[model samples]
Target: MQFKILQLVFLFAICSAANAATLNKQVRSLDWWQHASFYQIYPRSFKDSNNDGIGDLQGIIEKLDHFTDAVVDAVWLSPIFKSPQVDQGYDISDYRDVDPDYGTMDDLKELIQKAHAKKIKVILDFVPNHTSDKHQWFIDSVNGVEEYRDYYVWANAKVDDDGNRVPPNNWISNFKNSAWTWSEERQQYYLHQFAPAQPDLNYRNPKVVQAMKDVLTFWLDQGVDGFRVDAIPHLVENEELLDEPKSNIPGYNDTDYEYLDHIYTKDLPETFDMVYQWRQLLDDYTNKNGGDSRIFMTEAYSDINHTMLYYGSADGSQLGAHFTFNFYLITDININSTAQDIANTVNKWLDAIPEIYTSNWVLGNHDKHRVATRFGVANADGFNMLKSLLPGVAVTYNGEEIGQENGEVSYEEGQDPSARDPAIFDKVSRDFERTPYQWDDSTNAGFNTGAKPWLPVSEKYVETNLKKEKADPVSHFKVYKALAQLRANPTLISGDVTVKAVDEYTVLIKRSLNGSSLALVFNVGNDTATVDIAEDVSKSNKIVLTNVDSSRDTGSTVDPSNLKLEAHEALILSF
Candidate 1:
């Protein structure tokens, strides 16, 4: 009997060693971005160092330690280039210089150095689709300079029977009006798919394409890890100007951007080619510079099929972005959404993502409402777990770590260009979510020294700020930190994923490798839920992490065969 027991123990030891080897191999295969945490900062609202009402690069440097503490892998900053602030820095006048409103070029350089010292990668927002009308190239194009005349899309005016010149086509700008604006000096109409002050660049011009490439090289030289290319679907349009089909949506005015289908203007084939070319440029730069891979992340708010195309060609000869921004979590899942709804949304992306491509998850951004506010404060931690453990890159917008909510910005206090039209200001205003970060309960939520914030701060800052959250024994910040740390585990990084709706209101996600696994059981509904996950759990049954509102405690053992979760509760288990 003793001899038989020794042989059995030896067999078990061999099995354990083999499983450990498999876990190490899987962990070694992942790239930096795979299973990494990314934090997006809207610079103007992050922090203000000089009490200038606007956040700046200097302010970011002061708070750089925050990301280090949070275990973030990268930071993506919105546009900081010289601009007239027409679209809040989307209108770039100079791609190389930092706008005075944000900071000087030296300040940005200092920020990069400090961020690097903390082992954090920096990504800048690249606006290549259009430039500020005040840009030197646009100014020269307006003057009809021989070499610059083709820098922008220009068309001959269409003459009606009354002899009055009209726009070349029925194209409408996204800002809500005619897309073409006539220039008296050029004697032609210029295409502005967005705001009139932000004219689209003519990619048909080879010189223009190379000029943009040069801009990318300029930033790559500055040591930026990558770029978040904005509005990639708008990079190129149909050469032959054509009127888009009407959307025919009820109640929307004809002047509204939603009045017409955007077939001719967005998601053009050439736009994908443009993205591929930029990807090539980034790849070539890394080859020559001998550093970490510089990535290109494209932003295309198109349908799922169109958005996936931004990844690369179907044949896989050309690669576009490292990973296109995934907004399904932000757009599809809501407060009242069911567990099946969440499962379907997750499956939609996992089904569409190319086997060769990586995945990304975005919960909120500057343009959208805060997740806490959108899905209810109680659900914030639950969703964060979903985003963090999803077998890919997880992006967190500023103030998300502390469960910040949308601020109250009255119409009169709104500064977003989209809110300029008073008639629709209340409906389209983004100022509520773009308010200053709440650091403490002090004035302006401690974002600045004294001056009023650019937008109103949320009044809930007293209990919702980082200081308060960090102090609480059970808080969003604590849960977020635990989730961020778990991202480095081999099981979470490259393990096989299984997601399903355990019930109508609960989701069960399992990431397993070898014999070890991590499981997330979340109740997204309003009522309590009892989930039997015995089939999903393995030998170890420890609760690793729980949502801020969970009644359960971490490090406790529980029977996966019968688990009870309160409403809006999420628990991560290790087995």
Candidate 2:
């Protein structure tokens, strides 16, 4: 009887090992974006090769090995298209060519080719809502050319009761001005949701739709993997030209544009139709090329319910964006946010998205405050751990892995138009988060050899840089890289997320797939916390990774009956 019992126990161990191996293999076989990790590169701030104090495509090519080292699957570049630099690259003069400040067309093609050689996909920023006033189409329209008249939204000004000319509607621009800009040559007002230089394109024109689709096809033909659609909610506006209702609540940080509710100007139903058409075009391209389905991610910063609409309808008949960026964690989660707050917010987003669709999370980007500055260094590690372990795609802004903080930019050094505008400069300026990336501890942070960088480098580059973190075994950079590598595990990629509030400051999340289970415990508060573990987990002796010591222990076992975690620490255990 004793011999038989021992034999059964040994057989069970073998089965468990076999199952774990299969689970890992299954995760590795998932779709590219399913378990893929993305690194967002803001081109102008990434690297400079021409000694012009501006980063270019060649600079990005020089850093291709960095992505491979970090185990990133894709690189999402901000717009590098030909532009007038009025609103940076957002005001595009031409969609098919690279900006002169950045590089040439051949440079972009080479970057794509080299990235693919390293098994990394490249995604470009697509600005379909507007174009530079200098664009040929916009110039022609203003020239009274019949063929290009309707390419942009044009309206005739009206005389007010006081006999003064007024805008067609009361819609406010995002930059704190009238949405309509009077064009003297055309004797009319043109809509510009952003800056006057960026004239909003008229989606009501079928020719406009075809022209935009042609731009997508042009990039697709160049082996680009996908596009991060910019400002998707503002793609269309109400046709009735109605005035937006005034808001009773105060403006956001005293910005004038927030004085009214933007009902008539944004989040219109027609935007989804435009998204659907673009998605269909992407699918058709995939079918023709016999490659993986092209990715369509949109920037829709709305509530969970409204944001999910970008995915598709209930039956998934008219699929739109594959992944609408999930900013709930970024905007809501903070150092003071309770564990329940984090768990509830994440669960709400998970529940809102359909089962067929993949979820995504972003902690920081060029437009927002850096995660390190927003969530403190201690808490950032815990938040980053959660971001990496969560099911679906994860986007890491450039220089974030090294715990780079937001740089300080004086009024004189500010480059963003919003920062320069006297009305909104105090309330809305993104220059702090758009600083140059810190590469080393040398002068100018080793970004360029020419004049000072376009934006100042973070002051912490002396200790917080790629070279410094790469040498330190317990640095945040190493921790982030390990997390990216671990995401390849099927259990974390496809497994369902189950959360429990261990305490106000501590949270427990379990990811289970195919009878394989893993638990992630986080102490988000500023004090130590403890939680009880199940008997099976305590006895399994599975402590996979821990942020406290930056260790990944696969061979050791411990009794987790009374699991204790320091403030802002996280532990990943396997069962």
Winning candidate number (TM-score):
1
Error of 1 at 151 (Å): 0.7
| Candidate 2 TM-score over all chains jointly | 0.93
Q: Per-residue lDDT tens digits of candidate 1, residues 46-80?
A: 99999989999999999999998888999999999
TM-score of each candidate? 0.95, 0.93
The 10 consecutive residues of candidate 1 with the worst lDDT sum are: 1-10
In lDDT terms, how accurate is model 1? 0.87
Predicted structure with the largest lDDT when compared to the true one: 1
Q: Using alpha carbons, what is the TM-score of model 1?
A: 0.95
Q: Candidate 2 — worst ten consecutive residues by lDDT sum?
A: 1-10
lDDT of each: 0.87, 0.82
Estimate, for each residue in 1-575, the C-alpha lDDT of model 2 and write its tens digit.
11222232343354357577666556534567876788899999999988788888999999999999989999999999999998879999999999999999999999999999999999999999999998999999999899899999999898999999999988888887788999999999999988889999999999999999999999999999999999888888888788888876753433357777888877788898899899999999998898876887999877777698898885798898888899998877776889899999889888888887888889999888899888887766777888888888999999888888888887778889766765555457888888888888887787887578888887888878888877664677776876776676667866767876788888888887787777778888888787776633546655555663433343345556677677787777666
Each candidate's number of clashing pairs is 0, 0
